[model samples]
Target: MASPALALIVGTLFAQTARAATAWRFEPPSTSPTEQSGNYTGFSNDTINDTEVVEGKVFNRFVQIWLENTDFDDARTTPAWENLTSRGLLLSAFHGVTHPSEPNYLASIGGDFWGLQDDDYYHIPENISTVVDLLEDAGVSWATYQENMPTDHFYGSSYTSHNYLNASAEDYTFYVRKHNPLGVYDSVSQNKARQGRIRNFNDFANDIVNGSLSQWMFITPNMVNDAHDTTTDFAAAFIEYWLFPLLEDERFNDDGTIIVLSFDENETWDVQNHIYTLVLGNGLPEDLVGTTDDTFYTHFSLLSTVQANWGLKNLGRNDVNTTMSNVFDFVARETGFENTNVPEDARPLLNISGFAGPLNSESYIPFYAPDDLTAIGAGGQGVFVSDSLDTSVTYGSLGESTNLTSIDSQSPWIVVEDKSEAKVAVFAKEGNGAAPVTTNMLAAVSAAVIIAAAVYL
Candidate 1:
């Protein structure tokens, strides 16, 4: 038996301990902050110089709008997309890195998907640098504006769900964590200051009005607006409603600014993983409007183009080979389009055949086969194999042989396999967990725990 005061103090301390444990449980594991040398972290200590010029012009601002899931044909049918094409340069041969979606988003920023086959919460090692490192190194300010985000740096899934069939008439959670790549990486998530820079759309609007926009801006719309669940027409309408006005705004129309609009991946993976991509803004030459540039480009091109513009170092990934220099003349002049070819040894590994099941099927998991297992066959059922270099290989259930050596070439490949099952699981799990707490919140709770323990003693 204990005194009433002692019992009360112990109970309170136990409650505090439970709460602190809960907070720590939900919080992502933190890594040591990348060493900072000067104003930037994760870069060399040498003083950065930004003297490099692109196409005899230096762009001070780069803005990108990332849409979701709409194929090129469907996107082209949308009036809003047509309007943009009429005003900018459309890339006819642009393709996403792979399917279904998360890898493409990761590839766009990190330059390599790292064989990430699903959208599970991934805390990339801090040592794995991103475009943020390059931008920060060159003294360029950058931010990601996510529409419908619950908080400034909220790293959860869709806030809520509405019937996609009634998307136009109903309200739903637009902010999706998978679509916002920066939040997933430990390099940004573990850094309070860097995480703070990822603000909601309201902040983006305010920044625009206040003329306080960053040099680099990445914008992702809500599910409904970005066509993740809705039709392409719906997404186009949303873009028309929101983005058209910005084109007219002087802030985005300055000669030093460039705006890129693209999709994360296509609707179906059975066909080529081609997506519509366009470049517009004051930086585009007047003569190039309403024209289609057929340069072969991938998400890597976007990263490389930015690096070229800022004279930044590469992350030594796919960005080194697949840069879209010809698409952006500035990059082409500095580093010839053909000169940035991907090394034969550096191509991503391909997982040929195993199991192709529903995204929610128990068999589905985020598995990346070893790089050496380029052609594998097991389970003795539906066996499909193909790569970027060999486009004529037969696909479907195997009948006679799994021998693909005749069509397999040494050229760099982009394998578009069935990842929709994993994607479905990833999207369904969004916003399913507790919100993560900040460092200050953790520290305060820790101090409270210490005090409570002292009082109990």
Candidate 2:
């Protein structure tokens, strides 16, 4: 018979091979970092001066177009912004400005981006509460699961306190070295305030499965499994295998849970600029499946939607009126609205960059990174990106298809179209690296480019 140790090794290898074979076709490049890029990695500031990859043709043609425009400079110029009315889901290009990760997270839920300068753990501020408070006021149940929070304190934050319950918490602890083998000291010290709310990430699934959590639920992946990358392939795999299924459970029917997967912010420079948000949930249209939303949306818009849906009080300057408006329409009709505000012309916002045909395999870009940016009640502002052609598009308006034209270096302008409501901002690209050279003036070019592109578009 084969040796026991050898058998175990062979089995492990086979499992790894099988897992790799079946994993999602999309994988970060081999250059992915080991430490948590947290939110900023894989970002490139270069825009496509000319067609790097031609559009159309091949196995993953759309993927090709995405890759060709994949760079920091390209911006969220060509994403498909779907507005999910009663008909289908509308995805907007979710983008946040700034370098660190925490502030963007605050933007997504609380608005105003909270000015959280660092990702270091700190007690919640007294002046600033979260959208969780708003949800609670609106009678919406929500939960946040931090992986590894121990059972004795389901709301624990320390690595030792967390218990990975199959469904819920149980009174379990281990003793070693004369200390609670799982140290509860750190969490006890750090979470001096509002310690009741935090819980093990596992609890999120349990709450959803057991029907204990309210309609609104928030999940925070552990520092590692959240694609922060302590372990390679862990975050992406967890999302694909574990989290997606939990969100799809039938418990949410009368009022479906709108599941949003986003990054807190970019940490590394490479992947930060093109961070992505994946929205999956009930009442989403099937025809709009697998589409991208290219509208410029910051975290405040996300908070605003949650506020509107739950009837919660606004938290910051960003969420008040400037936030995106179409997110609530799926349940709007059901909430007894006579005529919903959802727009009719539904399709992806089109970008005419590199209109050349037939994309080659070399320049393919996959969406990565998810960050938060707040814009709600206070002195909050949301940044918009677009060219001259898009300025005429309405702000905060959803379910409309937009068309863009070629960007000549001489007239490079980006328009901000808010289809969810009514706002059109016209701005231009700044600086030139390797370029078709849209504008002649080298200094202060971004401002000049917008003026020119607006005039022509």
Report the number of the highest-TM-score candidate.
Answer: 1
Instruction: Write down the lDDT that model 1 would get.
Output: 0.56
| Candidate 1 structure quality by residue, lDDT tens digits, 1-457 | 9999999999999986774453111110111111121111122212212233233224677888998886789888677667768988887767787776877888788766755556645445454467887677667788887766756666555565443334354554556688988976657866786877777665655566556677788888776667775566667666666667677777655787788899988876766677898888887767777898766677887776776666665554556643332225544564433334433243332221123211111222111211222221111111121121122211121112211123221001111112454221111111233223222222222243223212211
- In terms of lDDT, the poorest run of 10 residues in model 1 is 24-33
Per-residue CA lDDT of candidate 2, range 325-362, in tens? 33333333333312223232432222111221101011
Top candidate by lDDT:
1
lDDT of 1 at 162: 40
Q: How does each model score on lDDT?
A: 0.56, 0.35
Give the distance in Å from residue 116's predicted Cα in candidate 1 to where it truly belongs.
1.6
TM-score quality measure for candidate 2: 0.45
